[model samples]
Target: MKTQSVAIVLHDLRGGGAEKMMVRLANALAEQNTAVTMVLLTEGGVNKAELSSAVKLVELGSPRTLSSVPRLAAYLREAQPDRILSALTHVNVAAALACAMTGMLRRLVVSERNTYSLDKKVNTGAVMKFTYWLAPRIYRRLPNPVIAVSGGVARDLVETESLRPKDIVVAPNPVLTAKVLTMMDEPASHPWLQDPATRVVVAVGRLSHQKGFDTLIRAFAQVADIPNLRLVIFGEGELREELSALVSQLQLTERVDLPGYAANPLAEMKAADLFVLSSRFEGSPNVLVEAMATGVPVLATNCPSGPDEILDQGRLAPLVPVDNVNAMAQALRQCMEQPSDNAELKNRADRYRDALSAQAYSAVLNGSVTVWGR
Candidate 1:
């Protein structure tokens, strides 16, 4: 067998679910003695340090990916890796354009980590509309495999972009990692988590409209009068001020805490009584699976693509409608009353183990016939 050189391209090693998966895959490839290089279209992010020494890091140092096309094409022309994998919309488009410009024969794998149609539906702004308009044109013309992290995402591509099933590979996101297992045992420093009497509900994601943190805040407000309960959100994003104001408006200033971005959210998930995902839409949420891996019960808004598939139609965990405060509140009450069994939840999470996902991805990179994420 010959060693293969692989390049994983992304906008950044941001704390987003897709970024984390990219880092994990790159690390896994390195561990297998494959030459791995992480190509970032941007400079820095929280997960930058998470890469092991075995993997090379190349920063394009561009604020936006459009400006980085020449740099990306140049890197591809010079490095000439056997395979290239890129994630996210902007970065994927950039990778496609770069590969085209370089006219490289290297196999290119691009991923759509979100449901474009649903995301556009939720965010009906001019920018989002333009992005929706532009993405399909690019994806339709791309000649390589398009990785969709979930079946729903794959279906979206077929329906929205007119891509064939053969062109889309539905590979589930890698969830379990050695670091995650190690972190699960580590204690969370929050005072609420330490209290045996206190029931802490945790939600982790960027503070954005798509995440529906405001909806989660409102749902928590409905149950705030419950004794020994606290809502702690572990993330930071553009909506911090708006979400904080909603918390204040609901008079949950003391009961709810937005501690910004947590470097080690697994510890918090391990310690917390429950984990919730209130996203308006998601391709495939890593945190939902991570929370289940920790043996903590999960409550997620059954929004596009991921949560329903993850929760197995609400058999493993509870699901609510997107932005439905009353429904979310009711579901929260029911969850508090009858928590999910830890072992069962962990069993569900076991399906997305990193080893399995890594092997599937490795097969793709090595040009092996593979079927996954069915």
Candidate 2:
């Protein structure tokens, strides 16, 4: 059988959850002997050299201006891959429009990484809201399927817009269990990890507003009296100043550490006493699963589209309401007081193992299963 070719389209090779997932999927697909290429819309950013060597990387350079759509379309037509899977909304829209014009892509898959309705709350400005409102209509006209990262995301797509259920599919993010397990076995090297007397509580994600790190800081402040507890948030973003100010204002400078982004966060998670997700909203949080894969107890916001489902209704990890600092604090205390069985948590995370998800995605891309309808 001839292997199908897949091209993953993204804005840039940024070190975010969605971008990481795209790289993982591309590599996983390529490992199956399929031709996989990552197509970047922009010329430069952080690149995913972590991807398997078998996968190719292609940058289309900067689009120059909004007027360069024709050039982008021509480039896709020239590449002529069997399938094109796009990661973010702008990239999805661009891929759809480009492929629509060229009619060269046999299958187009758009991965929606956040709750669809949250766009209204996040976009804020009337113009941005209007653009988001028009997304479902534009998405409907595009000649491809939409892949929602979670069931919450799929439901939001149907309820927030006039999108047909037939056009959307739920494909949760997969955890690279083997990589996580391997990293967990390695000795801790981070400065925070070396302190045997300190109890580490960790959160991993982009340091953005949506991550609700502000709320996490406030929650940590309430528990500052907890003996030797240190909060370490791993990831870089634009909100560093704001978060740092909040930490100082709350007199938690000693308790809270914003260590930018760790290339291998699982090692930190393994060394930590607790893992937390303080997002205001999410599509599917990859770190939550990564933490669980490390057999560390997790406490996450019961935000839309990810945590509840990933935690299996709190059986795998404690889920608290979004932005409830008090609840978050209480959950953290409970986790520390009576930690869940690590073996059980690792067992539950098996569902999100990389190989299992790769096989599921391969089945869909290979036409063995109808991915959109379900």
Candidate 3:
């Protein structure tokens, strides 16, 4: 069988989860001999450096996602890729409109990387809120099922976005590449992570409210009695000043540190005593998966989607309620005292391996399979 020509539409090469996953999928598809082209709405993000040489990159030169629809439509008309995949809400809406204009709507597959309704939470600006509000209407025009990163996210689409159950497919985020496994063996990114004398609790994500780093910090303050225990959250965002203020207010200045974005979080996870994801909502947290892939113990909030599924309803690791400082504190104390089975965690992480996820997405992109029951 001949390989299909695929084009992935993304907002940018930003460090966000959706952007990272798209980059990995494009690279993996190219590595597997599929003709892959990445169509970025606007250029310039940290992930731009990570694109594989085999995969072609197309920069639309537009100022924003919606503004690129005309250019994207032109590309579809010219390149006429066999399959098209688009990520996130605004870009998905743009892709749907673009593909429709080019008479290629049937070839387009839009992916939802977060609980679709988080629009009410993540999109505060008027333009974004309206865009998200308009998404369901646009998504309904899709000829292909929307690919959700987790079952919870799929359910959200059906409930909030009014998508039919049959119109969604649950797919894993293509994390845990062979390169990540190698990176795990590298030295810890921070001196505290490398020090055997100190026990580190690591959380990686943007320092924003959605990530709930404030909850993590309060929980850490509650567990300060544990000697040699420290909390390190890696990632930068708009909430850096606010979160740093919280740390100071809680008097956790010494015990907690906000070391902005780690170049390789797996390396930090490899040396840590435990990993925590305190997100309020997630499609499927790649950081949690990365820690599990590193064979490190984890604790996460029982959010709408990803954590519960990844932890098997808390059978594999502890799951606390979102923003519940007491529950998070208790779990953190217990987890810091005793980590879970690394072998089992590693096994669960295997389900999201780059090869397996890439193959599933490949099937979707090629239209060889539909509704991969996840």
TM-score for each predicted model, relative to the true structure = 0.92, 0.91, 0.97
Residue-wise C-alpha lDDT for candidate 3, range 11-109, written one tens digit per residue: 899878889888888888888888999999888788898899999999988998888989989988999898899998899889988988988988888
Q: Tell me model 2's lDDT, rounded to 2 decimals.
A: 0.77
Q: What is the descending lDDT order?
A: 3, 1, 2
lDDT of each: 0.85, 0.77, 0.88
The candidate scoring highest on lDDT is 3
Residue 300 displacement in candidate 1 (angstroms)? 0.9
Ranking by TM-score: 3, 1, 2
Q: Which tens-of-lDDT digit does each residue in 1-374 have in candidate 1?
A: 34388889998987677888888888877887789999999878878888989999999898787789899999999999988898887777788888989886347888888987776676576755666678778776666667888888988889977888877777768788888888888888788988999999999988988899999889999998789899999988899999999989999998999998776789898899889999998999989999999998889999888899888888888889999999999888888889998898888888787777777787766666365744
lDDT (10s digit) by residue, model 2, range 1-374: 34388888887777667877877777777777789888777755564666778988887776532234566687777888877788776666677667778875457767788887885577776646665666677778655557787878888888887688877767656667456578877766568777999998999887888999988889888888889999999888889999999999998887889988776788889999998999988888888878888888888999987888877788766888889999988888888888877887777677776666767676656655445223
Each candidate's clash count: 0, 1, 1
> Model 3: how far is 31 from its true place, Å?
1.9
Task: Give the local distance difference test score of model 3.
Answer: 0.88
Give the per-residue Cα lDDT of candidate 1 at 141: 68
Candidate 1 Cα errors over 4 Å, as ranges: 1-3, 120-132
What residue runs in model 3 are displaced by over 4 Å at the alpha carbon? 1-3, 370-374
